[model samples]
Target: MSARMTDAEARERMDEITRPEKPFNRFRWTITVALLVLFFGTSLTVDISPSALLALPERTLFYLGLMFLPPDLSEVGRSFNAMVQSLGMAWIGTIIGAVLSFPLAFLAATNLASKPVVFAARQILNFFRAVPEIVFLILLLPITGLTPVTVALALGISSIGTLGKLSAEVIESIDPGPVEAAAATGGGRLQRIRWAVVPQVIPEIVALWLYRFEINIRNSAVAGAVGAGGIGTLLVREIQLLRNWATAGTALAVMVIVTLIVDTISGRVRRRIIRGPQRPVDIGADTLPPDADRDAGPDLPNDPGEAGPRTFAPI
Candidate 1:
């Protein structure tokens, strides 16, 4: 003989299954309130007012009118040359940073290096990352004497911190199976990294380098404000000294157009790198016998002499 469950008991069991109880997060609410208070406090400290914001549109329009009314065509050649220099500086800087960061990334990676090594490498990267490219340019200007080379060096050194940290994170997130397999096959430290890690991380690292190159172009313009040789130098000279607003506007337009073009190209390349090569998979083919020699097809090399075993050199 079975007993029937009461309606209240059934409802209680259904509630337990369907709607699980959640804990009350007092700390989360407290933090949200604290953040709200801090935001208002900072706004008050900065003396922000609605009246100033209300006047912004009129002021901006006035400046825009001054800049683009006649649209000076006098310095078009000079602006183009300076823009090219900026691109060169950015490209060279990114290359230098990529070269320097590649090895340091392994040291900062937790999966690859000891705690002390990771900590030390991260601290070094942080120091470089904390300093802005403009500051680096300012310091190097005295030694390098206001050349594009100085701007390149500044951007390169500043880029190392961010690049190394991102690369270390990428290295740490890779699957551990390949690394374990490499070790099982008696590969040494460098050999394991070459065979198991470099192939996985190199594409992402190269994409990061291209992304940084786009950023460095803008930074190079900023460096030009301090006479480090770029379109920015032309801009400052025209607007601040000569009071040639139209020329300055032309330079600004050139900067914007070049940056947009580079960004578009780099973005497409990055997406391609991330997505990788696509191969169509056949479900029917996948159901073939497990013992089938898939590599023994006519398309594959039949003789050992035709296809030697692949080998990877240590980095």
Candidate 2:
């Protein structure tokens, strides 16, 4: 058969093997084309034409030059102080969000609360998320008087929705075994939550709070630009109000350096929190080479001593 086959037949077989089963799926092609149409159609509606895109790089370069070519170091001390203030704002905001969200998360969790309560809690969280931090800041301005504290309050309120939603998810995904065992032992709702739920969720929840802190750090700057007193305010004032490019550059540099340091430290802590203590590995006789014990080495014995099931205990 090999010698009898024509070259055309072999080529045809090779082509068939390489070809896809459905090379031109009408549904997939239609969907892709529809998405493309929607993207371009919507982009056009928002006035994002080709001409604007073509000039974007030049416009960006103009600002980049203003920020970094020769930053003024005269205001380094003041910029550093403002950067510290932003950090404080972020820290306080995170604490507020963590405290407020910790309880609401339980309420929103289906396993932890009745359906009605969960639904209501979710609705409340949704309301918080739907409103932007800027809006909250604006509303609170009259009361808080355009201070960094107001920025912190806005950030905290905005964070509640996100933190609560995530914490609820973590709660829902916890081990049911512990919860069931607690209930079996006549553990009341509070007892189950305290023993089973809190233990399992605390680490992840803390990690979430840390991550939120990192986000809030960035957000604090933006909030400051909107009338609050922080590095962001300094940056904006220099760039737009005072037209002091050198001063703006100094503030921008300080903000970047401080933010990077904070993010690095926070990320390390979050990773360590998530990856808790690991179990130590042990050697077993079954896997050792035969005659190893007799030859100043170890051998796998037929009757290996039994060790009870391993359990993790905190140091």
Top candidate when judged by TM-score against the true structure: 2
Per-residue error (Å), model 1, residue 61: 0.8
- 1-315, model 2: which lDDT tens digit per residue? 676768899898887786456677899999999999999898779956788799999988897887677767889999999999989889999999899999999999998899999999999999988988888889888998888999999889999999999889888878787788678767799988987788777877888999999889888876655769888888878888988887888888899999999999988787666764446334466465676667742222222122222221211
Minimal lDDT window, size 10, model 1: 301-310
Model 2, residue 187: distance off in Å is 2.4
- TM-score of every model versus the real structure: 0.76, 0.80
Q: Model 2, poorest ten-residue lDDT window?
A: 306-315
Local accuracy by lDDT, each model: 0.80, 0.82
Query: Quick one: best lDDT, which candidate?
Result: 2
Clashes of each: 0, 2
- The C-alpha stretches of model 2 lying farther than 4 A from their native spots are 6-9, 12-31, 48-54, 278-315
Q: Score residue 135 of candidate 1 by CA lDDT.
A: 88
